[model samples]
Target: MKKEQQEKSFTMSGEKRSKVYEEEAAYLRNRRSVAGTHTTDRSGIAFSGGGIRSACFSLGILNWLERSGMWKEFDYVSSVSGGGYAVASVLEREFDGEGSGKTRAEMVVDKLRHDDGYLRSKSATLFLLVISASISGLLTFSPIMLLCGQSASLMINIYPRTVDNWASGIFCAASAVISLSTWRMPGMVGKLTLFIAVFFGSIQVAWVTGYLPPNLRVGMGILLILSWLIVLGLLGLGLSHPLIKRIQRASFLGLMANIVLTFAIVLHLVIDGTGKTHTNDVLACLYIVSLGLIFLALLASPNRLNPFLVTYYKSLQTAFGNGRDDAIWRNRAQQGDPIHLINCFVQSPRTREEPVRSRGGENFCISRFFCGSQSLDYFRTATWSSGREKKPVWRHQTIWRLITTSGAAVDVHPTRQSPIVNGLPTMFNIGLCSWVINPSFKRKHRKGGPVFVLNFAAAVGGNSIKQKWIRLSDGGHFENLGLYELVARQCMDIIVVDAGCDPEYRFSDLALAMEKCRDDFGAEIDIPGLFPQRSPGRCHQSKFEGYIRYRGVDKPAKLTYLKLVVTEHHSMRMRLQSSIDPKFPHEPTRNQFSTKAFVDAYYQLGCETAALAFPVTGTVKRAA
Candidate 1:
């Protein structure tokens, strides 16, 4: 009886043990799931909070920094710039224990106030920007001139083959020497002047030669920018001692210089490629790519972009630039070279103060409208072509051939269906780029009326303002000599955007294609005009007054073809104005509102006036 009782106790004990083990196992599994979920949520919240805090803190600091009037000091800055002035002043008191140690947010604020770091970093930065700018100035001309000399000489055109001489060891060594020696100069300005003279002067030299092929010439151009970046990188790594402010200054200078140089390099790369080759296919990255390209040396944090990867990515981008569609290569064959976009400034009355002279044609009229140092402005020398060409013969797409008829001759190739003109793409040669005189003239007003010339012997009779008298010749203001070349090269026609304004169908140059607060302002919305009834070949004359832009996403907003700008203050003043009727193929949509859309609209608009204004009419006097 005792043995049986003992056995029963043992069985009960075993069952209890089994149940406890199972319960423990279940609890452990459940805890894992719950803890994992909580951890994920916490991580996400932390990141979100940190980002918000950083942004808010940065904005507050940025506002104070901007208002501190530090930027004004740039003019007085020598090679050692004190850019960190704003941050230093704010942090000076806090660091001395005059104020509280502060919270994390407060700590960030205080860190920015630390003037020493700011000055060190900033001083270095100033030198860098100036130097890099100088380098870019020099580089812009180096290769093209070399190529031009090669192009002119050697009975045969050996320029392309000799392009390998562009990035040779000598150029790199010379760039290195200039970069190194400039740092040792007495003042930053002197160093800058030296570089600018070396570089800027060279660009003129190259432009004067005007025979180098721009596309292949880009190889050396890129290397020049890279050389500065390399020198700065080395400086940053070598200089970090506390007493070595000069080293820091040089490092910072290298970094800042590279940043500026990078942007210039990118800009020139795009412009040189586009203007000469007519290939704007590459994406323009003004900030991020530039930031990554240059600041990798001075990132000062573990969480940063890798230098190797950044280098690789830049190389990839360059490769892509070299790899535009075959069509670009084909076009290069026909165009010979790019037409430089020489910037010309003029008086408001339309006269050039600085004339855009030819490589050999020295001395240009000075135009006062040009701001900053006139030295910074660029203008192109128009190649005096007789406006005639050998008919291009290359392959074309059916769609391409259908669009243009202005070419001397467009022929389809045995290969692809894309049309070719003079052995290049027909799209450019025959594409319509129409110009029009002021299209916003109204019949009733004469007192405060827009300026109109008197006794203009134009084929299309001028709708004269009662008091004003200026007759347009070929719809040209003739302020810029380069304008003549652009018009001739582009095969532009005069477009009559407005012959007359309809009171009911009033027009404004601004396209109110999209707007905010649609429900409140829909019916009243009109396009803010970026253009006016500009005389033929007038580029963006009215855009300065006011230009409102919108995209297709604001489809609900009601916009008319009118370009409405309020000139006079009036009660219930309807500033409604109209563009030519049938403004677009259909009403503007989001698809037609971006930068790309605007360019497309421009091309399409160019086509419309070809038929309207290309037909000649006899001359007439300015109407009163």
Candidate 2:
């Protein structure tokens, strides 16, 4: 009995040892994965925005991927705007296999097909509303202005020249409005609406200022000035609040742009119509000089930098002044305001005679004053030096205290944050249109958003311009959509399912997406061949369909773009499939897939695209 017990105890000990060894192996593997010591074998797929078609296509592709055993391999799936619907549907749906007897992808497609289901989605309806509202808002005053200006046309005894006068007035008004409004609206759709409203409003203002007598012009101008003052006062009210600084900046930029343009138009009408410049060459010269003086005065006037540029410049200053450089220089830069440092950088070379060279690969310029051998080394590159031995901490020069600027308010530098520092002539520097590395390695949403300069091309407003701070829209407006976000997250292999509803079948959107990767993020993706502008006519055309690999080296990730093609049969099927009456929910009828049948067809088409792109051979470069 004792021998049998001893054997059992020995077997149990061996089992315990085996379990400990397995746990240790798992721990090591997990550590390697977390540390990224081993090459990552993870895949991420992203869906682009394309109304209903994108929803159908993404769902279908996901369904096909699941069947081919590739769906489970994806570590992440992301989307923007319209594509969000499909992603949200999949995430929200119950895929328990027992309920509804439908797969998650199938259920999502069905929901899109349902009249009430698809129409109920706020995103689906938002596009049309924005378009319609924009159009209506712009033309709100056009008809009334037209009728008032052409009242003589209804009079039987009126001269035929009345028609000409009305037409000319209408044209002039539209031109003036367009000129005034164009600079104010930054968004594509917003610009369109501004054009329309300005067209009508310009007509009335032109008639009042151009044709009206001198007495009437005075009264009208006075009224306009009063109205403008009231509006400005209202806008300025409570702008000092920090929470609404963004909103205030955006609104103020638009209003200021409009005000300047309006003033210019009115001045032109007054000067030209009243013969202010018709006297002689002397009058013309005086007029030109007066205009120049006005422009210079406007430039000198205190105004906010366009909010977008302000944000970018703030980021740039923070990047340079933060303690990211060598110990001595970093400490010195940190003591000074970022804007001041930028000013100094621009004026560093001072005259053309001063030589400029990198102390290394680092972004440093030779100083004007000699520090001898102390500033020659890479550790302490020659930089702009103050006369004082000890650097003073500088504060941002605030022109308008009514609104909070982009960066956080730091402690005032007693040495440099005085009138002497603030009174220096400021220059608008566009040469340093580059990004600076952000020190804080946290999510953008946390800690008051990420701190980095944006592309100069994206600025809507800036100093020396009327626009103080223009509003920007989603990344989708720029065509790259959500792909940049995925790239920023450092995905290994990015599968971009191109689902944008391009009626012309152009690849401009794809081009823009690639540019952001290459230029903005320094991705090495290259297109082997250019895509044609128009489709080959047939919905089933093979010219631009299927998957094309975008090879990436180093930081920029590899991408596989799956372009989808819709056929006549598929389009018809998507239109016929329905779950509710046409009037019941006012179902979406504008898109390619309006009904249940069309939705199902696109869903099936998506599955086919996925199958063709991702075969089961395991030969394709799987993300993992």
Candidate 3:
């Protein structure tokens, strides 16, 4: 009976996966038909992420495509991070169905030119971020401090200062060190040491603080020692035993708890045992300030604030057009334009075990018809909600919100497990960006809202998929070039725009995408023209035609790669280099507050590079 039930469950899961694939295929077919490109051949253009620089560069490419009448040839536009900025703005304007008597690229460029400081200047938003951090610190740390204070007071009353207290403290510290060191080991030795450390240290603490009779303490200590020996004997068995694994995990957790409790008691005793009210008050204020600073450093650092400022600036009415932000997911794609795939990373919920793959998360795509990923399956975008009953839930998010979520370039990348290692630049503000929604069913009950504690816990815990809520951040955290999704869909002809920061032209983003594509989809991408001989005066080749041979597919698909680099032929490059900064196109991506000249220079560079790569007569060919 149990076997039959297990088989039934497996069959249901397989059916769900099939349904997701079919729905995605149907949506793509409809989009291709709308663009008049519903053929056996599939083509797509990918925009690489590099903040404002990439946005301007992609706009220029789009402008050239519009002028050359090649904009409608492709069926999909895949973008990540800043690359999504330009695409989202253009699509949102088109969805409004209001004619502006200008090309899509021109309208976006004009708006950006007028508001050149859109990415830099947001005093109000920055203030809000700081305030949010302060409040979060108070709410999160206050209870912890109060608990520590009560524990300290209880210890003072119950346990008088004795010589054994010092010994107990020493044992506690040693146990913490041993338990932390166990993270590096996976064998029985690590688990055995952890069990011994936790048990011995805990017994010492109880014996010293319990204030029992000497004979009773001696009896309890001997019993604990015997129990510890028995546990050590059991460790001789294989580590694969379920009971052993659980005990190992429990011992580690207990070790951490013991360390924290000891520190709190010591800190409270030192601060409040002064017996002078004035001194205690001063020390308490200092302690609170220290806590506030720690939270501020983690939550409201400049790196974290920059993404929020960029998102806020782009979401403004003046930036996109003077109209209400009424555009929804279903209307984001127009009839003649290609379907826009705004890629983001869905941070998985952490479990006890560490993740084997990308530590940051998986690739999540948001489009008009569907919103989800391959691992999580697909859901209808029209009726998607947060699913939590804590507050009023919206049926769908606006186009601007979706774009902001996609472009949220926080410091947490897919390679690292902790944000602290990256200087704690994780995005904790839930209002400005980062949307939480049900991954599978549209109406399933999901806990939602801006709970800072829960969000911070999720960020620290790393990414997994076994939780009630998923956090979405910058797609660049997984793949900056935005080509992975297109390759996953098996596009036959792909044009990639490489505008990321690459001063030496290393092509790291492209390399990352290549590695991931080969591993995930068994696709082999080869571009011989990427490496060219350098010339002093003339332009180095930035456009290369490659081919991708997908597994099980007979013929290789054509790939067009376009990169942004300085060339002596472009007049703007010479002019910008001479008058302004030497690094014209390769400026730091963090320079969101670029001057008007810088913005125009990048835009013109994009146009110049595209013109040189593919002349007016050039066209994107459909796959044979």
TM-score leader: 3
Work out the TM-score per prediction: 0.16, 0.39, 0.73
- lDDT rank, highest first? 3, 2, 1
Judging by lDDT against the true structure, name the best candidate.
3
Model 3: residues with Cα > 4 Å off, grouped in runs: 1-38, 95-101, 122-127, 140-150, 158-318, 326-328, 349-358, 387-392, 417-419, 426-435, 441-444, 532-539, 572-579, 618-624
The regions of model 1 sitting more than 4 angstroms off are 1-103, 116-128, 154-624
Off by over 4 Å in 2: 1-39, 97-101, 120-473, 533-558, 566-593, 617-624
lDDT by residue for model 1 (458-565), tens: 111112211122111101112111222111111111111221111222222112111111221222233444433434322222112221122333322221111112
Candidate 2, residues 368-461, lDDT tens digits: the string is 1111111122111123221222542111212111011111111111112221121111112111121211111112211221111111111211
What C-alpha lDDT do the candidate models reach, one value each?
0.24, 0.38, 0.63
Q: Global lDDT for candidate 2? A: 0.38
Instruction: Looking at model 2, report the run of 10 residues with the lowest lDDT sum.
Output: 335-344
Candidate 1, after superposition: displacement of residue 58 in Å? 4.9
Model 3 gets an lDDT of 0.63
Q: What is the lDDT of residue 51 in candidate 1?
A: 14
How many clashes does the backbone of model 3 have? Answer: 3
